[model samples]
Target: MHRTLLLLVVGVSLAFGVDWFLGEFIEEYVVRIINLCGIAIILAVSLNVINGLCGQFSLGHAGFMAIGAYVSAYFTTTLRVLNTETGETVVRAPLFDGAWGFVPALLIGGMAAAAAGLVVGVPTLRLKGDYLAIATLGFGEIVIIMLTNFESVGAARGLPGLPNYASSFWILTFAWICVVSSVFLQRSTFGRALVAIRENELAAEVMGIRVARLKVMAFIYGAFFAGLAGGLLGHLLRTISPSTFGFMKSIEVVVMLVLGGLGSLTGAIVGAIVLTVLPEALRDVEQQAKLPGIRMVVYALVLILLMIFRPQGIFGQRELSLKLLRRLLPGGRK
Candidate 1:
């Protein structure tokens, strides 16, 4: 326990130190991509709890993310007043003001998404595989459509001028918390029960596991984190539209999960990092090759090759650890 605590302290210190360095020296464009990567990691790992560990396929992450983004953004941007002398817009929030408001706004957004998850999950989680995926996909579309038409939240136009409260420090902190919590959840009895349900639902039920309840809980859990990621994204981007959380966004998250390796937290992190960085890295190649849409082609080819050569993904069901590293080394397996 002492060692674990020491490691945690070291990890946190290192993360904060990195965040400070990035803020002080790194360019905004690079920092933005890093922030997006952190958000992707949160989304991927959270979805892993449902799709990977629980063996349920869901595709409505965008819906939950939208809920969190809009709710939190709205909460923080409730009242806006014009400064007569300076002609600057001043924000006055009912609950809290300025940067401090982000804390409660994010929580409120997460809770709202969790509530939506419960409403959707209880009935839908009973369905299996493609059926569940379709249901969740439909739910995500419904959310986008509703937001697109809802005028209060700016409808299709989106909300703009949001305060940029999602610094690298906060983003990294939340990302770390989500990763650690997921690891613990994976080792718990609840996680085991979910795994059983994933492997064989009927057998798990016969063994006295409440499969339906667990499935719904897992869905809610995933939605909550997705919401948190959404909040961070909104703050980082300082603008959000209904179209931002469309069907493609959810598909992107799923692709990251699949690419990383199902049922592995480390895989989720790796997948998120790779996918987030890959597109930007490909931009130069596309520009030099005089191909505007080459990145999409590259993405397709990568997935195809991955499916053919390593269907289980880069990590499969395993994780990256000192033991695994040692075993993978030459002449180290004994």
Candidate 2:
């Protein structure tokens, strides 16, 4: 416990210190990229819980993210004013501003996403393999269509003017929290049960594991963090559109998980960072060479090469740790 607390303190200090001191020195675009990396880390890790650990194929992650983004933005921007004389609630400016409203709004957003996960998971999780994948894909498309038609959230016009409260420090803090929680969960008995089901559902059930309940739990847990990531992203950009959380967005997260090595937390983090930065790096190169769409061509080539050379992904279900680091270091034990 003491060690954990110490690590937490150190992590918090480092995050804040970087945000306060190093942020000023960095270019705004670089800072934005870093923040996006953090959000991607959260999304990838959370999806790892369901897809990696539980062996579930879900493509509706973006839908949950959309729910969180729109809900949180609504809470932060819309205010209800009560009038005693008319006994009516009037719409006014947002009730919460800055940091004061950001935290609660995020929580509400997470809860809302979790609820949506429950609603979807209860019935859909019973399906296995490609059927599950198709179901989730349908769900994601449905969500995007619903949002596009929902005028309250500005519909296709999108929601704008969200408070810019998602600082680098906050993004890092929440991402770290997600990392710790996911690691802890993976180490617990519940995590073991999920793994068992992932390996063989019938055998797991015979061994007394409640596959349905556990799967639902995994869905809810994963959805919650995805929502949190969405809220952070919405606030960071200060604007959001339904189109932003479309099928391609879900594919992006899946690519990170696959590229990182499914079921490996460290891989998820590394993959998120690498993939998030790769496009930007390529974009720079493209501009210099005056080549349009070159970044995507290179990105596709990299994925193909990776699949051919390292089919199991960069880490292949293994995690990086102090011991592994030491083994890789010079003059250290092999």
Candidate 3:
């Protein structure tokens, strides 16, 4: 425990230190990309808990994230004033002023999303594989449709004028927490049960595992962090609408999980970073070559090649470690 606390403290320090450096030396665009990577890590890692570790097929991540983003944005918006360019402003007393308010807002957002997860998970989790996927996909679509028509939260226009509170420090802190928690979960008895269920649900039930309850718990857990990531994303973007949380958003996250290697946390992190950065790199090429759709073509080709060469994934249910690195190096393996 002492060692864990020490490592956490060090990590926090590092995050703050990096934030300071970025603020001082980096371009705003680069910093935004960095922050996006952090958010992607959170999303990918949280989804990995459900799809990878728990062996559940869920397509409702976008909906869960929307819940978190909207809920937290509501609170944060209530706390701040929106100044118009014409010098007309609506002022209201702060709910919980400054950065401290973001904590409660995000927590409430995550809890709301977890509750939604429970509602969806209880019945939907009974079905397996494609059935569960279809059910969750419907739920996600319903969420987007409802949000689109909800005028109180901006409806089709979406919410705007959000404060920028999702800094590198906060984003990285939450991401680190999510990753550490998942690692612990994967090592626990409950995690073993999940693995068993993944192998064979009938056999897992026969072994006395509470399959239903565990599946719901995993769903809720994943939803909570998805909410947190959503909150961070909304704050960073400073605007959000139903379109932002569409089915495609969920598919993108699943793609990250697949590209990284299902069931591998390290791979999730890697996939998130690579996917988040790859587009920007391609954008430069698209601009230089004056190709309108070349970026998309290249992206598709890369994914197709990866699927052909490494069907499982780049990591293929494995992780990066000192031993793995040595094995990959020439003349280093026995």
Against the reference, the lDDT scores of all candidates come to 0.90, 0.91, 0.89
Put down candidate 2 lDDT per residue, 218-312, tens digits, no spaces.
Answer: 99999999999999999998889999999989988988998999899999999999999999998889999999999999988998998899988
Candidate 1 residue 88 Cα shift, in angstroms, is 19
Give the per-residue Cα lDDT of candidate 1 at 240: 94
Q: Sort by TM-score, best first.
A: 3, 2, 1
lDDT string, candidate 3, 1-334, tens digits: 8967986888788889999999999999999999999999999999988999888999889999999999998888753334546665565543655798998999999999999999999988678899999889999999999999886677888988788899998998888888888888888998888888888999999999999999999999999999999999999999999999999899889888889998899999999999999999999999999998898799888888988998788787898778999988999985
Superposed Cα deviation of residue 327, candidate 1 (Å) = 1.6
Instruction: Tell me the deviation in Å of residue 331 in model 2.
Output: 4.0
- Least well predicted 10-residue stretch by lDDT in candidate 1: 75-84
Off by over 4 Å in 2: 1-8, 78-91
Model 1's C-alpha root-mean-square deviation from the true structure amounts to 3.8
TM-score (all chains, Cα) for each model? 0.92, 0.93, 0.93
Model 1, span 1-334: residue lDDT tens: 7855775777678679979999899998999899999999999999999999999999999999999998998887664655668988776654556777888999899999999999999989668999999999999999999999876667898888778789888788789878888998999999999999989999999999998899999999999999999999998988999999999999899989989899988999999999999999999899999999999999989989998999898899889888998988999985
Which residue pairs of candidate 2 clash?
A: none
Rank all candidate structures by their lDDT, best first, as comma-separated numbers.
Answer: 2, 1, 3
